[model samples]
Target: MPDRVRPMRTVPRLGTYNGFGRTLLGRTKPDADGACFATHWFTLLLLPIRPLGRYYVKEGATVERSTGPGASTSTTEYVFLGEAELRASEVIRTYLFRWVVVPLVVAGPVTVFGLNSDAYSREHPLLFLLLLLGIPIGGIIVLAVALGLREKFLSSARVPEWVGSGPPRG
Candidate 1:
């Protein structure tokens, strides 16, 4: 007897090339056609080190809600018709924006304000101490605020035009 309700297995298995495929980024919100851009990366220590490739595909998820110990519930997957295309710019921009740009944007002003706004005066050694303390604390506070706004920030991110001309995968 043939199997029924077969989940569409991805033909080109990602994350297996070079014995590593990790960090799928630049996944667009579902387009009008219900497909999105999915970019995978090669990672070291779970940090995306380089881009592997990208595909225009339909995203999939399997959610298992559980209240048990060590139980994980959500997983995301992508389905592409054919080979993934190398899209270096999109991947790099996404990576750099997350790791570099966001850091500078978030922390730069905090640091500036901490340094310029707070003076380390010799008359009050406490001021010096507070300056030192406040820099890190203020930075942490700003960082926390940025983290809190992460979902909103992510929601507003723009998705670039997919270079792949092929039909969107489902």
Candidate 2:
């Protein structure tokens, strides 16, 4: 009887995955070579919403690996594409809209409710309190969903063919 040979297994190479960044909420993770991936999570906190919502942004390179002449020969390449910076002006604009504008717009209703609390409570105490509490909670939930959808749209729009593109450069 002839002896059977075992097939060789190939293992994927491991690289660094460290995070670093500074903002309201953001992180960076290094990839192979000199490229790194970054993600930013922007949130608004004001008005009736305790935590308004989040907007996410990502920047990084695309990596592509191709096999050479031999099965053991493989080459890895990188391509740098995507938004690299988060401008302060844009962030300030978003902040102002969420913090100042939103609160000012909501103040009218809140003031009316405050002034009529006595009559409102007398008529429907439970509902009055519920309205006050539900405002913030409902705002949070609605804003969260909206932001989540926006994030998905923005991420998809940024790079439709990001996969197998190549690694990013500085």
TM-score of each candidate?
0.48, 0.39
RMSD of 2: 18.8
lDDT by residue (tens digit), candidate 1, 1-170: 11112222355445433334565666655555665566666765444677765655666775557758976444556666333446566677677866776557656655675566544455667776676567666766776686557634664333334333533433
Instruction: Compute the lDDT for candidate 1.
Output: 0.56
Best by TM-score: 1
Tell me the spans in candidate 2 whose CA falls farther than 4 Å from its real position. Answer: 1-23, 26-89, 101-109, 154-170
- Residue range 20-97, candidate 2, lDDT tens digits: 211223222222333332223322232122221222223334454545654332223323233333435445555565
Off by over 4 Å in 1: 1-21, 44-46, 62-73, 107-170
